[model samples]
Target: MFAEFRKFVMRGNVLDLAVAVIIGAAFATITKSLTDDVIMPVVGWIFGGFDFSSYFIRLGPIPEGYTGSVNNYAALKEAGVPLLGYGAFVTTVINFLILAFIIFLIVRSVNRMLARFEHQKPEVPAAEPTDVVLLREIRDELRKRPAE
Candidate 1:
C-alpha cells in the first residue's frame, strides 16, 4: 500500500499539478497586491480619490457601544454590523479580471511558441505498410523469374 501511494505521488502529472498549484497560489498573491496596492489606487485617484472597498450599504443597525466610525466598513463589520459590501465585491471582480487576462496572455504566448516549434520540426517520411512491402517483394521476385 505504501509503495502504491508513493507511485501515485511520484507520477509526472501529479508532480506537475502540485508545482502548478504552488505557482498559481504565488501568482494569485501577486495579482492581489497589484489590484489592491497599485491599480486600485490609481483608479481611485482618477475618480476623485474615492475608495471602492469603502462603498457599502448598511443592512442593519450598528451594534451598541461601538466606538468605531460609522462610515468605516471594516470597523462597523468588526462591531457586528450587517452591511452589504458592494465595493469589496467590485474590487474582487477587478482582481479576477486582471488575473484571468494575465493567464490568457501567458497561455496565448505559450501556444504561439509551441506552434513555432512544431513548424520548425523536421518531417520524417512514414514507413511503407507491411502488406505494400510484401507485395513489392513478390512483384520483384516474379519479375526475376523466367516468362511463363
Candidate 2:
C-alpha cells in the first residue's frame, strides 16, 4: 500500500499538478496585489478618489462598545457589525477577472506557439516495407528482360 501510494504520488501528472497548484497560488497572490495595490488605486483616482473598499451598507446598529469610526468599514466589521460589504466583493471579483484574463492570455500564447511549431515541422513520408521494395525490384528486373 505504501509503495502504491508512493507510485501514485510520483507520477508525472501528479507532480505536474502539485507544481501547478503552487504556482497558481503564487500567481493568485500577485493578481490580488495588482488588483488591490495598483488597479484599484488608479480606478479610485479616476472616480474622484472614491475608494471602493469603503462602500458598504450598514445592516445593523454599531456595537455600543465599538470605539472605531462609524465610517470605517473594516473597523466596523471587526467590531461585529452586520454590513453588506459590496466594495470588498467588487474588489474580489476584479481580482478574479484579472487572474482569469492572465491565464487566458497565457493559454492563447501557448496554443499559438504550438500551432506554429506544428506548421513548421517537416513531414517525412513513411518508408515502404522491405517486402514491398523487393517486389517492386523484382517487377522492374522482369520488365528489363527480353521477351521470350
Candidate 3:
C-alpha cells in the first residue's frame, strides 16, 4: 500500500499538478494584490473616492450594552447586528474581472507567439541521398537532350 501510494505521488501528472497548484496559488496572491493595492484605489478615485470597504447596512438593532461606533461594520457585527455587505461583493466582482482580463491578455500574447514560431520555416534543409540526386540529374539530362 505504501509503495502504491508512492508510485501514485511520483507519477508525472501528479507532480505536474502539484507544481501547477503551487504556481496558481502564487499567481492568485499577485492578482489579489494588484486588484486590492493598485486597481481598487484608482477606481475609488475615479468614482469620487467612495470607499466600498466600509459599505454595509445594519439589519438588526445594536446590542443594548455595546459602546462601539454604530457606523463601523465590524463593531456593529460584533454587537450582533445583522448586516448586508454589498460593497465587498462589488469589490470582489471587480477584482475577478481585472484578474480575468489580465490572464486573457497573457494567454493571447503567448498563443500569438506560439503561432508565429509554428509558421516559421526551418532554415536548413535535410541532404538528399546520393541515389536520389543522381537519378534526378540523369532525368534532367535526358530531358535536356534533343531527339535524333
**Clash count, one per candidate:** 0, 0, 0
The all-Cα superposition gives candidate 2 an RMSD in Å to the true structure of 1.5
Q: Encode model 2's per-residue lDDT on 36-143: one tens digit a residue.
A: 998988787776766876778999999887888999998998999999988889889999999999999999999999999999999999999999999999999999
| Model 1 segments more than 4 A misplaced | 130-148
Candidate 2 residue pairs in backbone clash: none
Model 1 vs. true fold: TM: 0.83
Q: Who is ahead in TM-score, 2 or 3? A: 2
For candidate 2, the TM-score is 0.91
User: For each candidate, what TM-score against the reference?
Assistant: 0.83, 0.91, 0.70
Ranking by TM-score: 2, 1, 3
Question: Cα RMSD (Å) per model?
Answer: 2.6, 1.5, 4.3
Q: What's model 2's lDDT at 50?
A: 67
**Model 3, position 63: C-alpha lDDT score:** 76
lDDT of 2 at 39: 91
Model 2 misplaced stretches (Cα beyond 4 Å): none
